[model samples]
Target chain A: MFTSKQMHLAQVFLKIFFRDRQSIIFNLLFPLIFMGVFVFFGGESEPINLGLVNNSSNTISQEFSELVEEEPLFNVTKGEESELKRQLFLGDQTAIIIIPESFNSIDETAEIKLLLDASQVRQIGSIKEAISKSLLSIERSLRNTQPMFMIKVEDVKSRPQRYVDFLLPGLLAFMLMNLSIAGSGFNIVEYRRRGILKRLFVTPIKPQDFIISIVVSRIVIVLMQLSVVLGLAILLLDIKIVGSLLSLYGMIVIGSFIFLCLGFSFGSIAKTQEAIRPIVTSFTFPQLILSGVFFPINSLPDMIQPIAHILPLSVIATGLRDIANDGVSLLMINLNTLGLFIWIILSFIVATKFFVWKEVAG
Target chain B: MNIIEVKNLLKTYPLPGNKKDSFNAVDGITFNIRLGEVYGILGPNGAGKTTTLEMLEGLKDINGGSALIDGLDVSNNAFKIKEIIGVQLQANEYFESLNLSELLILFGKLYSNEINTKNLLEKVGLLTKESAKPKELSGGQKQRFSIACALVNNPKVLFLDEPTTGLDPQAKRNLWNLVRELNVGGMTIVLTTHNMEEAESLCDRIAIMDKGKLIAEDTPQGLIDEYASEPIQETLKGNLEDVFLALTDHRLRD
Candidate 1:
């Protein structure tokens, strides 16, 4: 279905895209810089600084705080109750735990006071859970296995997904969307402004041929971007790609095509270059912020999460992470695949219906 | 045989914010272009000259009539029509960073026409500037490059709309000579110009339009012979400009 004319046009477009320094940075170098930063800071979670206050003479209290100190999740500091409380209140510690004097043995039950920094609401649950789990382990050592309650922790994946692993695929998806939407939209509007499309319309080449050329050219650029960014990420950040390379590329191709169609829709709707900015920003900015480029969709408000999850960028980013980090197959990522398919059809319809080949005067 | 025929071609546009109010941009104008002749549509700005030319070029839709090029309906067969017609729009812009030869080769590929890029550039006197970007070329060189691009398809009919509108006098004369040479090479030419001298010197026949209707149509000398009565002064036997001024009245269009 490809034509030589389309290939020739695509080659010409590549030359133009590369020759323009602004496009090179926007399309390629900026994303690479992002990858470098993300990879450098990837995977390492922040350590919570904790304050320990022991009032009891019991050795168990001393041992329990020592256990908590050894855990990588916390940076432990031991101090007097008043000082610890002051530090906790001053926002120097994430939480302060106090073991009272009466906390003795298996025969007696003693109360422990846990003063948590309420300002950091998001970390409260995890901190509470980790401390409680540690206490349970200490209690189990004291009281023999009553078997009243048993909880076993297990990882779902063969390997745990680090923050970098989470970020790499999302960045990839974001890069593809940026390349397609901004790149494609800017191109058509520029050609329209310059009357290039009007000039081409007088030729024997059909509009379909021109569109095909654009599609082909955009795909080539997207691929180059993917390889460069992903290559640097793999070499520098040590990002693990568990999924098939073919499948990852395949997903990106389909994903980029969807955004390219959206770009065309924006191009057709915008009458001039000035009009293009707001239109494209309106489309891209929402997805960039809300579509889980930096964080998971669940991190957003519950009311907006549903909307964010369905965004093309969200679906593609999440889907790529699933395949690359979770080792999920292409067919298994059906929700994202289905969402992208719907977008492709809808955007293609809008583009074809509203496409303006020449400047229409009022 | 007439190479192009227009029969009561019309284009009406609805007034903004008033759905029911409509006006004819080109109101049922009719004209035929003969084979190997330079036909000029002469009119001031906002005179609907461009609308008529664009409709025939398949760049605009005909609201109420028919136009045929080489006996093929323009509306139904715009693609086929485009294959055989070369167009130089008033604002002829091209892709940047592409040299003249690259742009021409790209244009030739669009038409599926195998063209000699060097020969095409030489015809427009831009062979020496073949490697220069379109933006780098001078205004007159740019116009010549646009013409070169248009001719890439080796078109049967060439259309130039105000092709010399922004050129210096020397460049304008150079373009006039180029147009004359193209016409002599047997390409049926249809151009629109508001310059009376351009029309008189370049066109074999002229159609003068004002406010969407043809006020007069004839050869340059024939128009003067028929309408140049009551010249500005008895001493100055008026030319084609006098014929145009006398027909349309001396008033600024804009």
Candidate 2:
């Protein structure tokens, strides 16, 4: 599908991209620096520390303490009630659970007082669910008969996903988006302002061939960026790739195409290099903030979550995350794939409609 | 025989802020350029000289009339015309990151031709600076390199738009010499400029445009004899500048 002329032009563009120090710093080095900062601040996930205070001297309490101790998700420590509360206050423990004296009583209901650290409130829901599951198992065994109502749970095999695992995919998406948009947008505008496009237009090359050359160059750049960023994450940060590399690369290609089309559209609309800055910034800045590149989408306000979920960057980030973290195939993420396709069609239309070979005086 | 035939050529641009209102930039101008000849279009700024050249070069669309280059209609066969024509714009337009040799090779590939970059650079007197990027070259060197880039395809017709507008005297003389050499090599050259000396010295025929209309066209000497034969102060006969002043009734700079 590519001609020798397009290949030659693409090679020239690649040479220019590498020779320009600013482009190198912005596209490659900046992403690595951000990854470094995130890896430093976002430390490895540690098991939750739970302090257990058993006031009941019954078999039920003993069995519960043993069960909690065997769980890998928590570090359980048995101690006095006051000491456990003091540990919780001192941030040594995520929560303190006190088994009341009435826990051994057969007729009366027993209440467990769970004192949790406020700063670790995000773990409250999971901690409560785990504790309740253990208590229900103990109660059914103690009755020595099959319970009339029982809930069956199926465990799906998957690795424990860490914050860095999540951030790596988002970072990849971020780099691709920035490189495609700024690389194409700024370069095209500069070409127009300098009359380079006019110079090329007078040649025998078709406009489509020119644009194809840019796309080919950008795809090559995206591949380079993927290697450096993903390689660094895997080698230095000990990141494990759960999904096939092919799927991740495929998603990246789609994402870069969408952003590149948007860049072309923006490049053709703005008349001067100065005019392009605000236009590109307006489109990219909001996506950067709302796309959940550095954080999870659910962390955003409820009102803005819908908007964030539907953004091009968000869809790309989510798709990469699904494939990288959960080992999901490209076709499995139907909605994300569909969303990206929609963006590609929409942006391609805008780009072709607005793309100009020469700037005409109005 | 004529290699380029232009008849009632017109290009209209919509008036800013009003699409319904428009003005012609090249209004009903008709001219022809013979094979292997240097033709010049002279006028003041905004007289549409550059616009006229652009239409014939197939760089701009023809809004109202027609132009044919080498038996191919420019409007219908724009790409075909581009293949046979080389255009050098006014400004030094090139990729800043690529050296002259690399730019030449890239342009050569665009025309699907295998070219000798060193020979092209040597022809433009920029052979020694082939490794230097466009930004690193001096103003004169840059203009020469632009022409070298245009010649990569061995074009039949060369279009230069104000090639020496911002050049020093030495650079201007060097470029004029290069143009003479190219013309001597049997290349058809078309140029637009406001410089009267350049027109009189280089062009075999001159067309004077004013406010989007052609006022006069003939050999430089023919024009001097026809409209500017009156003797001026300190001179026995008037020159092309006097012809311009007499026909337009305004200075070339105005």
In terms of DockQ, the best-performing candidate is 1
Candidate 2 DockQ, CA atoms = 0.45
**Collision pairs in model 1:** none
Model 1: residues with Cα > 4 Å off, grouped in runs: A47-153, A331-333, A356-362, B230-254
DockQ of each: 0.46, 0.45
Question: DockQ score for model 1, please?
Answer: 0.46
Model 2: per-residue lDDT, tens digit, A1-362? 78988999999999988888786766778878887877787775566788888888987777766776776767889999888888888888988778887778555678988888777567578777876676566666655668788667654654556678888898899889888987678888888777888888888888888889999899889988788889989999899988899999999898899899989888888878789989988887888889998888898889999999989999999999988988899878487778877888998998888886644211
Place model 2 in a CAPRI quality band: acceptable
Please give the TM-score that candidate 2 achieves against the real structure: 0.79
TM-score of each: 0.83, 0.79
Residue B241, model 1: Cα distance from true site in angstroms: 16
Best by TM-score: 1
Q: lDDT per model, in order?
A: 0.83, 0.85
Q: After superposition, how far is residue B71 of candidate 2 from its true place, in Å?
A: 1.7
Native contacts present in candidate 1, fraction: 0.73
